[model samples]
Target: MADASHTSYLPPILIFCAGAVIAVPLFRRLGQSAVLGYLAAGIAIGPSVLALVNDPDAIRGTAEIGVVLLLFLVGLELQPSRLYSMRKDILGAGLAQMALSATAIGLVGWKFGLSVGGAIAVGLALALSATSIALQVLEERGDGSETYGRRTFSILLFQDISIAPALALLPLLATTGAQNHSGAPALAGLGLALLAVALLVLVGRYLLNPFFRILASTGAKDVMTAAALLIVLGAAMLMERVGLSMAMGAFLAGVLLADSHFRHELEADIEPFRGVLLGLFFMAVGMSLDLQLVFDNALLLALAAPLLVAFKIVVAATILRVSCSSSTEAIRAGALLSPAGEFAFVLLPLGAALGLLNTQQAALATSLAALSMLIGPVAAKLIDLWLSRRAGPAETMEEDFEGAGGSVMVIGFGRFGQVVTQALLLQHIPVTIIDSNVERIRSASKFGFRIYYGDGTRLDVLRAAGAGKAKIICICIDNREAALRIVEMARAEFPSARLHVRAYDRVHAIELMKADVDFQMRETFESALGFGRVTLESLGLSYDEASLVIDSVRDRDAQRMEIQYHEGIAAGIQKVPRVSPEPLVQPKAKSKALTEETREVIEDGGAEVAVGGVGEPER
Candidate 1:
């Protein structure tokens, strides 16, 4: 009977798996974050519905392992030098926020009639914001190296490190109702943690990579992956036995591997599993949400949610402003760190299990924590909107020209742009090229390419590039939207220049023609076809036959595409009338008098009269 019962439950598990498969593409297309979809799926199949994983403890156990991996990967990315450089931001803002928020929450809990120690434990739990949500928000903004990014990372690093000690201390605080452990055993735990750190440093420097190199030489991909998993899980198991959180163990393993050449390879191999397990973590969170508790305590839940998030935001912002300030950046830093993170979920159960929190308190904390995670995108969007509004209005005036005696301006520095710049340098053209991507700018600089950073659509940026009196302006922006905007700005601001442009397709060629700025070439069509011709020559085709094929392809693209351009324009004009069929006209002798009379009427602010032009039939 038990075997039959187990067999009967297999279909629903398969069905839930199918639902998860369908959710990935659906969530991606809708622009909804994957975290939301995971939560939804969990709720759909949880005990309240499909009941796929009826044992919450089992689900929690697996998800906890996911958190362990997440922290391990995070530690791997933070090199020693990077962490050292970030010390001020990390220790200053991180500790300030943690301390202030903890104090505020403890006071609040005390006011609500909790015991002093219980209140302090609950406050500490509430003080730590979600690191995962904060990191994700930063990643989306491309500001992962910006001032706020640096500061945010530092605080998160400290929290990650401190979580272990807190976990150890929590049991004493809750179970024994004491804050500090007695002499010998307390000294032993601290001594052990310190020893573990020392041992990791010694082994990592002297042995880990050499060991990994031998494993790599074996050329068995699974062996390397298995080794990585063992290192993380083994360290975690060791930490658990010594009364430390798994996070500390996993983190130590990561730090030891931080300088390894195999770090990137290991990260790639583990990424697929990390994503799955992270999803499972979110699912577990959803499963733990108790609808009955929330309904019964609606008012209290409502009050706690915003207050919880706001407290963190205020504390983080204040610390950032004091430690790393410019009014604008401080506000941005505050806005960025405003969301509560995934750590709160982990802390809640740990706090409760340690006897620091009651069921109601943990439930309230969880609800508010979930709400904070959901508000992240909304807060980020508000920051973006504020920044956009604060930027200067679009420029309509011509840029001031300075003489371009030593300045040679290269508009686009893509492949063709690089060739032009290099040729100019051989003859001494003294060029400065403009590009927008920050990463690309760094790479080009390493290769000794002269490049400036700016979006070319702004007239101010063009002026800075000496656009007004340049011998030539080359438009090399690959994106059609940006290219068209540049053309419009250049035409309005620098009409004297000879303009060269890259056409994306035949349709692009026609649009550039209609705009009346004529020098244009398709970027790669002819060159790619030429490569085909060379391949044909290598494949035993006659030179004449290959040349003929190349010529045919080129003419079809360059000449025939031109014909299609005008033909489409003609078809469009034929379909729509160019002018209205009403006109009032006079012979040349009376034309000036009629114009004066019309001008006098317009001086009284009347609507202007319509007149037919070339496309209209004779009137």
Candidate 2:
């Protein structure tokens, strides 16, 4: 009997597995988003389609756990300090997105004949962009930590948090408050929610680390995985108890463990489950989408989904603009978050229960939410395509590297590259020079230089530039990102060639070192040090004295770069001082006279540097 009971589930499991295996790879090959694949798969196998899996609600409960796990993993990535830095985006941009999106959408709902309360409920529900889908897209593109990614995430986080309030607000919005719906219940629920968060924080701070420590001592990998799930589910359950989303609870749990030593272990344990379940969640959402309702109200949905998406885009883009985002960021974010989020499923039903919306209105709203999610990925893709078209293509010149493959291949013709080529030529070594700049190439040819025109970032260009035959490749591009892109490409394309790169700054130097290049030097580093040495010599110091000071500073900088390579720039600030602590002369014997110029440098010693490298963020 037990064997038979378990055997009955295999058919559905097999179907789900088959759908994913066939559809996911196909969608990927077709250059479509995997989220779209899962959704398509779900709709195909759902009750509304082939009817292989008749009850979407059955699987939805389990698939939702994927969302919880995803949030927990997201939390692990954010340190408290990083989250704190996004406070403005969370409150300013996030709040503005909600207000404007809801208002615009609400007006549309009112025009469609919904009661004022129903329209407000509808607007609020649709305003919340699908967190699961947006996060999945960001994760796929590896943009979660980027400014645009962070900004989008901030709004999503705020939306997740606002669900509880939206729920409480529903009763108040209802024209008929039969159950004596009042502010007291809302205030009480808020208190309980706060208390739950406090409890989670307390457990995270005092108990989780010690518990994990005890668990780790047992050498039980399986138990650690179990514990990871336990914490995620436990956090989710707690938040659900207070009418908050389980995903939000998991996120809070993750943030609590962010500073813990076990974070990586927990993350590693949770990753596999997160991926599978997230896929399942996407599929379940597709299955849950009522295609019949969509067909029943075809014209209504057709107008609603696109108009609603447009409203959301306008509101989000406008908010991002006001919040000081770049035009590109604002545009991407507006489109990225235009889809109605999963919370609509929860809120629309709750509104109906509170009499804020009738059954028909609730169903229509739910259908609209799901339809927006289906359209979200498509919308984002279209926006990207449009942006790409607007930006146009980069200029390129014809590649010709005949009779090339010299001992050294120099891959830039900028000021930095020109200087590097001069040094190589000074050594009497034959060099193959390449640059994609048409004007630069034209000018170099006029100067009797054989500078081949080619984009260093392209693999074919590198091969044509004699990268395969060259013993050394010198990358001296001014763009930090381009430099890194070339570094990765050259390393992969020409493993035999030793790479020497010109980095932009300390951050670039660190990245280049991390890439394991044979040699990397900051373009400004030596020049700046030389300038300082000369300035010291000019200010009443002997050449030897100035040289000694320069050497010490260079030594300190070397130590700082070593630390930055290991633990980022923040960890290097105190370890490596800009100036040596020891006086030029022994303090015990004679007090050394410090110049006013030297003292000024000492006063402004340490400063926080940008991660973008060379005065701009690479992202």
Model 2 residue runs over 4 Å out of place are 56-59, 111-117, 142-147, 167-176, 179-186, 242-245, 322-326, 393-529, 547-619
The candidate scoring highest on lDDT is 2
Please tell me which predicted candidate would have the highest TM-score against the true structure. Answer: 2
The residue-by-residue lDDT of candidate 1 on 1-619, one tens digit each, is: 9999999768655754665676645765766556666666766666656676668766677567767887788778666645765687777777887788878988998898777666776677667766665676665554555566767777888777667666666655654564464556655766786677677678778988898999999999999999988888888887777766777788888987777767756765776676676676676666666666767887886777767766676677777777747666666666666665566677777777766778777777776666666565456556656765797442222322343323456666777777767878899776667775656667788988757776576556687777776756778777664566577656756777766777776556555655555477666554655566678669765555555445444443445445555577533422221111111121123222233543443354322121112564211
Candidate 2, run of 10 with poorest lDDT: 575-584
After superposition of all CA atoms, the RMSD between model 2 and the true structure is 9.7
What TM-score does prediction 1 earn?
Answer: 0.60
Evaluated against the true structure, the overall lDDT of model 1 is 0.66
Predictions in order: lDDT: 0.66, 0.76
Q: Backbone collision count in every prediction? A: 1, 3
